[model samples]
Target: MDKSSGTVGVFTAADVAVFSVMLAVSVGIGVYSSYLELRYRSRALRQVITGALLINICIYMSFCLYAPSLALATVTNLSTSASILIVGTICTFYITIGGVRAVVYNDVPQTVLMFLGVLIVVLLVCKETVGAAEVWEAAGEGSRLEFFNMDPSPYVRHTFFSTIVLGAFVMLYWVGVSQAPHQRFISVSTLPTAQG
Candidate 1:
């Protein structure tokens, strides 16, 4: 409870319900994957059943890993302990049983769903405030929308050259060197198959 107001806390009943639902859904997905595994014992079929890499990057970036798990939990209207428990237990189970293949497969859809959630939040915010145009302007009110900053100054944070050119090199280097990407890369047989 909050000391001053005697309010219960950040997470309301609704928040708990939502978080519970999310955890339950993840558990269901895991169970379903297991069912798929048991039903199709063929190694060839299992390889095709799997997915992409580093989807956990979204989680790490969004949830900030161990230290900020509490803060991230609070933001999501979950208690710190509950958040940690849900993520830790569920992920361990999937990865343990399914291995990196499970991680990669799950990451693909989870990343898509994460973005979809963000898009929903954006739409809701726009509805609550003003239209999408106002939201766009508000984003630009800060310099976040400045993608084409052509400044050559090293001190400048987000010059077009720095973001587009340097960021490409960084991405290329990461793709080349990152263990997660390489694992995902080799999971597929051919470039065309992977692309498809």
Candidate 2:
């Protein structure tokens, strides 16, 4: 499908398959690397966290370089897309490497700020648009707030149940094994401090 500016953003079935394969490969790499880290019993967790941060920074830096290059030279859309995809994948790689502690500690303030910003935008949007009563009426009729809809479809992106299940899994994985989360485990001076 083309966007308003006539940019081809939608992919063919083959492209979808390729994207899926790339996603699976990235996930597999993350799982495999984590297993290696655990099995080797090497490197303090903090180093891992720092390394992940550095990796992500590097990935973003590379993209920054590419953006300038794209503007200066003639590059195909496919090349630009691939470069962006590489940056995104490397970002995930950085996260997986940084571990849980890095993710959580880094995210804590950002998450809070994100929620506040989102809430402000939502309130503004609501005030500018229909009033609360109309919003509720629309929601009740499932015009604006349906996930699975009145009827469930197998291929839908996510139902509430599916979201809960996936969210639980993600929570467990990130909280249990992430370096960012693990840092807190090791940070306490003593058991008493930890308890406090």
Candidate 3:
């Protein structure tokens, strides 16, 4: 079983029901807007979608490679839901105020530092697990080593099909819909610089 329940469990049936409604409504709106943007030949809309897709891909890859193994009993599994809403709100606020350039500049060093930290933890995990060769063999014994070991379904992270679909949705939302990201265009000194 999932083992997560009550507060620890991110989604209950009620939550799923609400989320399903929200998702359908939001997606319908997004699709309509995207159609309008494309019909109008809106460059700004195109750029935002493209940029969001790029960001999503980067994050997804990071999760695949850097995420620590988690079971139902893991600390994060228990606390993720409580923290996620607050964290997401804060992130949105910061991004909205800081604009695109600020976000990108801040993320550059953050990404570097995050990767460094991940590297250190991975080394430590390796040391604790077994000899390097044995570790590789052990990992290979599980499907974790397989790039697409998980089922290629929407339920999984990013199947070959879902990536394009979800990635496009993410791109459209980030580029076309987000006010904060578009603010960067006007915040810049000149149109050429903003375009760049």
Candidate 4:
């Protein structure tokens, strides 16, 4: 990064190399995991989850690909549909061969990339706007920080008690009783490890 221009606008060769290597490593991990895949059980729960997950994938795959497709289209001649097809195919290919194990492994790097991407955007915003402090101060001066609403009125969109209670219930349902979480839990070996 060069800040001599009063801003970090360029990605250096080292940055490119690091990003390229990280992606290559992540893909290598994913492919290696595919070779290690093993067959698992058959159950009604799995069948039901598969049907629901397919419907979700159909809807969310478009949502997930839209932003990236726009970005790719901006820089390349690739159309949005083509970009989506390429990405979707690559994703489906991995899951086809590796089962959930590949997803579990690939998720580690994907999550890292997601966080790193957000962090880079945030840092750039901070840099462009002078500093994080000023940006935060501006936000705090607005309705953004007015999160704690103690009003018990039903007309209120969000309230402190309602938020806390509903959030707790949602968390409980997802963490303890959700099929997705259950699948993750059972993915691990041993009862104690699964519980943990």
Best by TM-score: 4
**Higher-scoring candidate on TM-score, 1 or 2:** 1
Per-residue CA lDDT of model 1 for 124-188, tens digit only, reads 99999879899889888975687667898878897877788788767744553333455555565
Residue 143, candidate 1: alpha-carbon lDDT? 58
* Candidate 3, pairs of clashing residues: 48-175, 49-171, 49-175
Instruction: Give candidate 2 misplaced runs (Cα > 4 Å).
Output: 1-109, 136-143, 147-154, 188-196
Error of 4 at 194 (Å): 8.7
Instruction: By TM-score, rank the candidates, best first.
Output: 4, 1, 3, 2
lDDT of 2 by residue, 1-196 (tens): 2344443433345433443343323333343234434433444543565577569657767776677556534455556656567655766687688854455456657888989999998788779778767767767798566655433454666776667777977775455444333445454335554444
**Regions more than 4 Å wrong, model 3:** 1-104, 148-157, 190-196
TM-score of 3: 0.39
Question: Lowest-scoring 10 consecutive residues by lDDT in candidate 3?
Answer: 64-73
Q: What's the true lDDT of residue 150 in model 3?
A: 48
Whole-model Cα lDDT of every candidate shown, in order: 0.59, 0.55, 0.55, 0.60
Per-residue alpha-carbon lDDT of candidate 4 for residues 1-196, written as tens digits (9 for 90 to 100) = 2345433434345533543343323333222112112112234434554576568656766787777778877789998888878777877798789876566556668989999999999999999997999889889888566678999876777789888888987775455334444444445555554333
Q: For model 1, what is the error of residue 144's alpha carbon versus the real structure, in angstroms, after optimal superposition?
A: 4.1
Judging by TM-score, tell me the better candidate of 1 and 3. Answer: 1
Per-residue lDDT value at 52 in model 2: 78
